[model samples]
Target chain A: MTEVTQPALTIDALGKKCPIPIIMLAEQINHVPLNAVVSVLADDPAAYTDVPAWCRLKSHRHVGSYELPGGGWAIHVRRNY
Target chain B: MAYFDAASTEPLHPQAREALLAAIDVGWADPARLYNQARRAHLLLEQARTEVAEALGARPDEISFTSSGTQAVHLGVLGTLHGRRRAGRHLVTSAVEHSSVLHAAGVHERDGGTAETVGVSLTGRVDLDAFAAAVAGHDTALACLQTANHEVGTLQPVTEAAEICRRHGVPLLVDAAQTAGRMPIPPGWSVLTASAHKWGGPAGVGVLAVRKGTRFRSFLPEDERERRRVPGFENVPGIVAAAAALRAMTAEAAQECSRLSALVDRIRETVPKIVPDVEVIGEPVDRAPHIVTFSCLYVDGEALLTELDKAGFAVSSGSSCTASTLRPSHVLEAMGVLTHGNVRVSLPRGASAAEVDRFLAVLPGLVRRIRQDAGVE
Candidate 1:
């Protein structure tokens, strides 16, 4: 169900709270093609656990998640190619 | 004492204090009795009902007293859902409702009723279209929304929301804990709940009003009391005090609300400007006039609250960690605003402009101290 908007993925989930990052990320991933990288920026602490669990369950790769400068965080996920 | 936590509980108005003391003996007897003391108690209770109903924009027959706002909300929500059980097991509500309503929703879910939390924009307004969608498809038994948030003071569009619920044949229950004595609710609210403490009345008194046509049922176990709605003996003196305080508060609400609104507007305009990296939360225009909130970047919320208290200014805050297992404020987080280090200040009724000035003077330094303590420049 990937939209494949671009092979180079862009998902801006910043300012989104828990379940939202997962929800937004899921929506964006559907648009991406196989093997695409999606960047997610979220501030919610729950997103830290939710995103990876979503990736693991969906068989997508959670490339990584890191703290964003100035109070938020960044997460990267790859679609299952 | 400088109590800025009016959101938590306002100082009892002078009239309410007088009423409570006077009623301790006079209204103490059971109205169910035949003695003169009982007759006096009956008169006082009836008068209190009239006064409270008028202040709350409700009818006497519709308003029933609860021991606290939390109870009112619980009874209102669970009771309504139970009454409508034949309709469906699904309910809809906003994300930023007070813990009372949210807690009721949890109970509803546990009881096998489905709960769908509608999203609120960062400014704390419900997403109308999304809200409609949540209630649209399902057998939505009821919808609950707060007239104004207790924590951030953001006002919700209850009137419009009522229309949406009406369209989908859903009853909207409004928790008016913050707005009851301030502004009148929209015409279409099916059931409404409020706390007297939030508006300068003593604790232990809450108001629940159900529209005449609403097919709601009480959730509490059977008793001849409350028409089988709320349980237990009524707090007669507390009800007297609630009625008196509501009357006194709203008598001057017109001028006072405007004055306080302007004062809070000043705080909204000045706080972020004076304190660097501080981001004020809530919609500037759509919020109640007595409260304002802001999150200071690199500042610790608990520390800011403590410093303010030490400086002779009492304020309130929901610690970031306490917001959820999730984050600070779902409303702030939903809005995508800064959520760290949030502080909510609610001005007391009858508070002076001088107090606001004193608070403004003390706050910047307190925030700076907090920042320093947090090891932020």
Candidate 2:
């Protein structure tokens, strides 16, 4: 079995609304090294769907999302180039 | 101001206004009464029904007027589920149906019934294979699909869907509020519903048509009016106006459709090229002629709409920031498209090329300004 790697960077966009989370992700995802994971913590409902859609559109790998203990989601994305 | 929100409600047609005034003078009496005035009123009501029915390719007896389109949908959906209870309590619908259909499904689910929502594609068209599979289940009582999507304007394959429902002995409830006057109601719908205001008729008028031999038992408390299908007194004047508007619109549809189609095509082709990072939503070819939707990547929908409004353009959006629920439009989410910075421009009849060009010219700058305000550029 392969060992799990922690996210290299985590974006705390908890209280922000839609498009903000997506914009933050877009601006910051390039900062991470290739194939490294970036986790975005967003409570806005649009992020749940738009983040994955954005990943698909931008050609990045969408790692699985995990629900935070507090009422939000930690959406993980792995950079592809 | 340029009105680009015809899908929300079209401005009243001149024919509808004239008919409404004439009807108010003579159709004020109760149609159910035995007086001479009532008899005259009944004739007008029946005449309107026949006109509407002809437009829908249905018989006069199949048409019933409801107070609003939402009511028609409720009755069409719940009544069918109730009538076919012996068959099953399951409902099948696409994910992009108007809130009326989805809310009716919600009510059914709350009342101990099961529902399955089939998803759509990136172009906002329903997956026919998935829809066929969803309704192929033995317990599905009814399936619902729109003639065309209200927001994105993608026309569903109603004929094919109807064939599938027929094979399964399931009824199909079609919400044709978007296409009733603009285009022919696609054939094979077991029951159909439409709102008058969408067709340049006055508000408070709705059409509910159920084909003969379709079993629809009303769930609401019993009333003798509307063949015991819809309860309450009829809006005779409104119904008359709605019928007149429908007939007039139908006559103009072929010409208006092509004109508006070319305008919409221009918007669809130009929006993406003129505005950077914009994705035009909905099917490119199989969509309704009058509506086009698009989304910008970094701008907020409400801000863009407000700026456009300031610039004398009235449009609608499906962005989370614009919605009261703070959620993106279910239709956009279902299609997996960008939901922020959304705009749905549904052209009204007789919309000019100059107006469309002006809109196209102003939109890119508005989007850019909104993006800059949001610190995107």
Candidate 3:
């Protein structure tokens, strides 16, 4: 269950392996705090576990993480700002 | 004939063979049984645990036996992830961990947890900056890094990675599947696992050790065996043999490792020079001394492996043994190297130089044959 009605940025981090995706999204999320919403796209299976957990530790709201048709995920995240 | 697949499974050592035969009558009884035979079984089990623990520089109470090295990793990874679930759901591991650890990460995700993957460089090393950043965002539960890759023999900097994991207060699980029987993990690595078969020991015996005060609890259903970390009836004879073999292998390590290291280094440096357009995998400096891998362009790896076998060489193909998939070696792919004609020659202890010379003598001809068949110049 995700908390909707927050600022969003669709960060498509699909198919990126390891620290590459994590670093990209972290840099992207730093630009604008409140309205920054990242929808991460990833093909790496580990990202399914890594992303939401990243949300939990950062105090940002993990809105909803749903899979796309081509095997990537659309994880909507909002900056804690 | 020269055999170079010891990384997969070394043949049984004479010490292990003797121990296996001796233990058949004495250690076959269930350790849990109250009878005399059972007491003997229990004593053997204790001795095995002590020897293996000492080899890994671990306390006796910290070690638990599992059915296989794969099982040990499965239990160790799952236990660490579950135990630290409260810290955060993100688990961090390298890209080139064994299939067992990869699958365990899958199980972790199936339970609604997430995993942060660290990428390896073309040299088969994890990027430290990336590693530092992966754990920065989350209360990472555990970070799993193999000591040396089983296929390419690349050693991860577990010490540096462990330092980062410690900074995030995450427990590090080191799969010393290749190096545990040969090298020590030393001050780094919180949890360690190894297979007996990799070190000329009997198959079906694995050691999983967790350091004291670590937050690792098994995900397996509660059981009376192995302090509830691993649950199953013991393979007593295999355990006894594994213990005997491990001791023997490590005892000879000072001399044998240097001998094999020289052999492997000669192969690593000379193979590419002698055989044209062959790319060797794994870090030249930071890898196991027993394994050397290379890809011959334009040749089918399986065909090359078969050709080597026909030439009285029992080396291994890095290509996945899954015939149905028919894919090239994943290890080579991750290292960003050619995957077409990958051959992983893992020298066993006591392998002679004459056999190595014979194999090398016959290698370039086989490579040309396969390359010609594949229509590649």
Give the best candidate by lDDT: 2
DockQ, per-model, please? Answer: 0.09, 0.70, 0.02
Stretches of candidate 3 exceeding 4 Å from the true structure? A1-81, B320-324
- How many angstroms is the interface RMSD of candidate 1? 10.2
Arrange candidates, best TM-score first.
2, 1, 3
- Each candidate's lDDT (Cα)? 0.80, 0.92, 0.79
Model 2 misplaced regions, further than 4 Å: A1-5
Candidate 1 C-alpha lDDT tens digits along B285-324 = 8888798987665555666776777788888765464343
| TM-score to native of every candidate shown | 0.83, 0.98, 0.81
lDDT of 3 by residue, B144-183 (tens): 8898888788888888888887887878899988986787
Runs of candidate 1 with Cα error greater than 4 angstroms are A1-81, B321-327
TM-score of chain B of each: 0.96, 0.99, 0.96
